[model samples]
Target: MRPPNTPPARAAATATADDTEFRTLLDRLSDKATEDYYNPFTTFDWPATIPTDELWMSPELLSFHGTELMDELSPARLQALSRWESVNFYSLNVHGIRELLIEVTRRVHTPGFELPSEFFHHFIGEENDHMWFFATFCLKYAGKIYPDKSVKLPGAPRDPDIENFLVFARILIFEQVVDHYNVRMAADRRLHPTVRHLNHLHHQDESRHIAFGCRLVHLLWNRLLERDPDDVALRELRDYLGRYLTTSIESFYNPAVYRDAGLPDGFALRRRLLTHPARQAAHAKVLHKTTGFLNRIGVFDARH
Candidate 1:
């Protein structure tokens, strides 16, 4: 565990004895990481064979799940869709982890991160291993990891405080969103063995990341509040989080998954699924815990 206030000076300002809330939480989190250390490379037994006839993701968790489209698909077709959907899910993990690596790597050596650097060291290594196995599954079974072509949002705030706020907030959002899937699929015995193992391994590591993120976000929100009391930065952050969460949920509806499933008009299906009220409800459910936590912490508001 990183000491209460590590070197590099700036970290002490935020995490020294003065900030008991953050220091205590970070200390607890660091201990948990150390005690729960895992080597992702050797954790799961990569199956000798992936079952083609079995479902890869729970039927209830599918993008078109609970919709008319789900009913229209034959059982075999649904099974096929699940296989591709699992690939899409893993592919998203790969891409998300890649972005996280870039963010954490740049910050680990920066001034404010000195205290968190120790945990970030473990975080980066675990995430890299995650990306490797996820991409391995995608490439082995699905032939390729799907590319993210969604248009990137612009106008990120230039203020360093707000920027820092956005960084951890976004990290929290991404982890919690994917964790909704990981927690569910990890426990569902009906899915393929490979899929279950993948989700289980990810869930174990992410439990630590999510705990660290929740505390870090709370601490940063406090700093953001003290540093920018006018609520100007808060409003910008709320807006970004709203859009970011929505986009994170919608990423599950990849057109490539549809195309690979032999479904017609992949783009059309993505459009329909994303716009459906049922799908919107499901998205809300997926985001319920995360959004609620953010709102409770005053980092997010529905009216913002």
Candidate 2:
């Protein structure tokens, strides 16, 4: 076996003498960023007015944890369920993109990262415009944008060091988790035309976001390993990541959704979905992607 100091040949093949050459990893990453940069600002045509609709969600992809409850609703109520879910989903994206871009701005400026910083600058620009469209749609059609929640997950407070690596990891994790559902909506040709269009656009952008995010987190983790090799620290990071997944999936069945559905008790239903087996499985799909990425980065219990 080769010594630990020795580079794997495939990696060595493309590495520079100064730093290990990563073959296509950096190039592909930069390319994706470039494409996002070029059209990110102009990717979608903003409709002057959003059409009125009861459901903004694609039914095929609804988590279905408590969807049978839908059978109890009148036609109008059922339509409201769809609208609430779709608007809630996109509104969260708008909020997330705003916060994440701010983080991206700070990271793009760290020492010795000049070469790679350009992509992040462009990435943030795209996200800024993306936040605009999503927020605009909600304002124009929904009459009000969804507000951010004060919910806190179980974890250490975000310190600067953690924010540098951990926040990006958190953002990356939650976004892919979103794709676990949004992908279904994007492909469901049966959804309302406007809903379909919204999902289709967001899905396209998020595809690139997840790609860069996975690679970026892995890159950040490697840097962390060089500084501290503690297994506990690594595990804590993974646990924090797991908490976000749990909390985020739970956010799907919000009080607003429950109240809009005309359910008398909102918090109780939210609790049930968080605990229900079927819903748990759907939630698991989101966590699994993040866990897998952590495993690939040598940060998790990989025995599986």
Candidate closest to the true structure, highest TM-score: 1
User: Runs in model 2 with CA error above 4 Å?
Assistant: 1-24, 32-54, 63-67, 153-162, 302-304
Model 2, position 29: C-alpha lDDT score: 62
Tell me the tens digit of each residue's lDDT in model 1 across 52-155: 78898999999989899999999899999999998888888898899889988988867666567778988898899999999989888777889975557676
Off by over 4 Å in 1: 1-17, 229-231, 302-304
TM-score of 1: 0.91
The TM-scores, one per candidate, come to 0.91, 0.81
In candidate 2, how many Å is residue 63 off? Answer: 4.8
Evaluate all candidate structures by whole-model CA lDDT and list the values in order.
0.82, 0.65
Worst ten in a row by lDDT for model 2: 9-18
lDDT of 1: 0.82
lDDT of 1 at 240: 77
Per-candidate clashes come to 0, 5
